[model samples]
Target chain A: MEIPYTISTRPDTGLWNAKIGIWLFLASEVMLFGGLFSAYIFLRIDAAPGTWPHGLLNVPVGTMNTAILIMSSVTVVLAWAALKMRRYRAYWWYMLVTILCGVIFLTVKLAYEWPQKFEHFGAYIKPEALWKYEKYLGNQRRAEKGLEPRIEITGHLHSENAKEYEVALDPVNAEPDSPAMDRPHFFPLPVTDKIATIEKEDVERATMFLPTHSAYFASYFTITGLHGLHVLGGVLVFTYMWLPVSKKLYQRNPEHLANRVEVSGLFWHFVDLIWIFVFPLFYLL
Target chain B: MSLKAFHIVFIIFSTLLALGTGAWCVWVDLVEGAPIYLAGAIASFAAAIVLIVYGVWFYRKMKRLRIIT
Candidate 1:
């Protein structure tokens, strides 16, 4: 049996069936994202001042991804408009650009941004050894430039697991290009400059910040990961729409193809819309 | 009123609500010295503004063409 309203508007709603269906799906999607956003708010509010991580994400990279997604949204709309005007070639070109943008956005996110977070480890130093560690970093910086070491404080690195080991206060190969080195002083030693072998009892806790490290990370992974999945889904759908099957449909009924593009375009817009919020909330202020 | 016109109006109203809520949250965050909700709120406001402008433009174009009358 032929489905009604696939190419024309229904009498009651005055919208094609798929258009109504997409809107309903998008409404549910909004609610899903809304609840997660609420959870993010709650976590941020409950976090203690100075405990919430800031300036951890690379802002420039995130801004690039945001621009990419926004541009893709434009292409999506153009693709749909081209289809409506019966410009099949233009429609395909726009759709291909949209898909490419999605692919690039995901690549930057997973390849560059996420790995930086994973490679970073944070160690909680004991109050007594904290000052010594600062001095060690200073000495190490001078030594790296061929200058004489100033002062060395040797101590055992204490991890949160209660494991203690006598280790040098020297910069280890653990973290290269550590962001913490630029800051005055902070927890989770970005790098160790020089080895100062000291007693094992002087250290506090050492921990690596994985996704399980803090509430902030947990929410970050959850929200961004979900968004990534959505991007992937959009790319796949657009690719399928660009396939010969859709072309055959277009030949049979151009309006049906146009409606398909419109429905997909609506979804693509929503994906971009979510990223607009995600970019600022995750990367910027 | 026509269903199409009603849909457009509903979207406009929703956009306005998003803009208002986003602005309010941002103001609160500024006063409170960086609340978690502020970032999302600001983003939502920005996105809402873009969407509102686009929607209004599309509405006008449709009206001019008698597509949504």
Candidate 2:
């Protein structure tokens, strides 16, 4: 049976069936991401003062991913335009580039960003015991002598029990609250390796910079992980359409293929829009 | 909506996002002490300019084909 309005607008809605359906799907997606974004804000405000992490994420890489997603949106539009003009080969190449953008974004997120976080570790130093580890931590207090202290040591760690942890410092001066970290890296500081073996009484908490590390990290992983999945989903859909569906459908009904591409393109644009907000929220502000 | 109309809307929305993100990047660079955000700011503004150019060209191209209103 023929699909009604597959290639034509519905009289009442002035949109094709798939277009309306995709909009409705996108509306639900708005709610989903909206809730997650709200949660991020709530968690961020609820964090202890000056304890929330900033600059822990690679700003340049995040920007690169944002640019990749934006580029993908452009390619998706170009592909749709190509389809409209009956330039099937142009459509094919544009769609492939769109898929590659999604792939590259996911690779940077998974292989580089997530892995770096997992390998890194941090722990809060017990305020009372701060002076005891002065040789290693150097008593560089993050608080302004009145506020609750926010001293965290970051490195690769090995912890066999809740009582103690052994950490070889990551070598990069990752002290977020330290004014020194603000300086751009020009040459490696000629400092010898420092390791800390802390007993439970002197340790407030310790963790790899995973989701469990803090509220900020938990929200970060959840939102970005979901967005990454959306990118992967778009890549799969576009790949399938490019290889099998578009080839067969164009020969039969190029108009239907165009509508399909436009529908997918609409979804692609929405994905890019969400990242525009997500990038500034998590990575910047 | 027609594909042509939606195309215009999409380009406009993307340009707005780039412009907004560019401003945000500037704020982040100045206030947040991250000089790297300047690069993000430059990229976003460039994207906004590119989108505007592309939108104008695409509109004219579509008009030439009598495909858009």
The TM-score measured for candidate 1 stands at 0.67
Candidate 1 CAPRI grade? incorrect
The lDDT for every candidate, in the order shown, is: 0.67, 0.78
DockQ of 2: 0.38
Alpha carbon deviation, residue A162, candidate 1 (Å)? 10
Worst 10 residues of 1 chain B by lDDT: B1-10
Find the candidate with the highest lDDT and give its number. Answer: 2
Report the number of backbone clashes for model 2.
0
In model 1, which runs have C-alpha deviations exceeding 4 angstroms?
A126-207, B1-69
Span of 10 residues, lowest total lDDT, candidate 1 chain A? A179-188
